[model samples]
Target: MTDGASRRLLTTRRSVLCGGLGTVAASAIGMPMGAPAVHAAGRVVKISMQRSSVLFTVLKVRGTLAERLAPLGFEPSWHLFTSVIEPMNAGAVDIHADVADAVPIFTQSAGAPLTFYARERGAPSAEAIIVPADSPIRTVADLRGRTVGVSRGSGSHYVLAAALKRSGLSFADIKPAYLQAPEGAAAFEKGSIDAWSIWDPFLAFAEAKRPVRTVADGTGLTSYHRYYLVNDRFVAEHPEVVSAVYEALSEAGRWVKANPEAAVALLAPVWGDLPPAVVAAANARRSYTVEPVERAQLGEQQDIADVFLEAKLIPRRIDATDVKIFRPSTVKG
Candidate 1:
């Protein structure tokens, strides 16, 4: 969007939030600039996503990040891909934002150097088992022997498999209908599949448009969620950039929590064509926590890695500790 358009939408968003919409106003205001001001003295970087919210957050400067990055010549350029693993595997993007649980699968399956950096707190059960509103799949175990939709090798796919295991079932117990996000959503609408496992915006979009009901999400059935990941070698060389990105994301998390209503308003334009209530609901469920990587977190990732390895989800096991890089003190403005 042009600077004028972006700012106008931003202003309108603030108004929407302030009108007792319940979301806090965007407090990180900066003098709006006209054009991309990222001609700084650093290497230009490309961030990747599979149509997830973090990708939107990065490019739109959707939250606290806009202010924190205002100082750095760090303008964002978005790169879209089918899955977080593919882009990082190809080494096409320098920074990759993904679910923390997914790190073990790609990094260990392939020698991908992406490491867990920051996390999106309050992870919504967005990526849940969605059955057609009229479907007979009322319980998790009901998913057995049914064809479920998921993207092969994506985080949602992994989570769905993990969810199934909790019911004492495995991939062998059900039919996994492999399809991309859009295709999967469409298939679910047609009742061509028993259920669809997916993440938001798409999850919200599907739920609103189809006779679907959420059967599982990021909760008791599934606790592992996504985390911001940076290229290992890239972060080692450009720690400052890594730090800047983290600080910005941390701030964005704060802003999202503080001003959810405004955040949803700003999100509306991005998702204008979609259902507003879905956006509002999904936004409220998103976990936007900002904390430095801790050993406990690494241990959690390691636990995921072990599960994926046991399931042979990834090609091999990954030593998560070797890649859980963080420098929170330096990631500040």
Candidate 2:
């Protein structure tokens, strides 16, 4: 079916199942009958995501978001995009999940009115600087003057920068080939780039298909924490919906951790029918634990902003914690 038509169908299904509940909820919350329902009755929560986001992939595949949000009165709509920060900055989506921490720094610098609601713990090993198994590049230091492929503004981008610095080198020490993960992988396979810095399941996919060695993972470099964000206006107008989404995602994270095998089975097709083993490997490296966004947790983000500023990647320096953050009272049990 066409994308628009499919979304309409999902909305219809959600309204039919939860319409009455939303009205009751609205009344309970002291909202007038003429006012918008607590569940957002006719509103659809457009979630912006990418295929690489395993938690979102699982939630989308299971189709549980609709049921979970039915009482809250919001219909879930999924929008696939290449980059989370771009679409969010353009006002294309109300919410975005699985965006790397570095992306917000750039988006904020660009004046996008975005705010953090939730974050996943650091999964340093999930991203890495990879090289062909037999390549002469044996260390991050060896990358000097060599071409390294990385997706600009991604978590891996920061990982690469930090890796270089840790090696007593800087971005100017090497030539950077800015490419998306898929293109970077193809380029790496074609021997056009000396190394490909990327995150899973692409990392897992490449490792499964070919022999590659990790020069360095994010271990001592970056936190690799993914953030869940929403437009500033959305949070101001519909804080409950934002809360519901954070709770739903937090629950999904728990489910994935508890049932790794099932998560792999469900995510395999969404991830292009990837081998269950590869999916499992990728999932294993990820924390899959969601938590509320905290200022203390943003130290690395500040560091990322500084790094990008130093490299002139972002237009200006930004205070990572200057943006809004929604902290709901109750954590999901």
Residue 298 in candidate 2 has what lDDT?
Answer: 82
* Clashing residue pairs, backbone N/CA/C < 3 A, model 2: 39-72, 39-73
* TM-score quality measure for candidate 1: 0.79
Consecutive 10-residue window with the lowest summed lDDT within model 1: 24-33
lDDT tens digits by residue: candidate 2, 1-333: 567766654553343213111111111112111111234365687777665666776666676677777777777776655556667778777887578777888788889888889888889999999999999999999999999999888999999988887789999999999886666767877889999899987788878878999999999788889998898888888888888777778889999999989998887655555678988999999998989988877888899988888888897778887878889655643
lDDT of each: 0.63, 0.77
RMSD (Å) of each candidate, 1 decimal: 7.6, 9.7
- Model 1 stretches astray by more than 4 angstroms: 1-42, 55-74, 122-124, 330-333
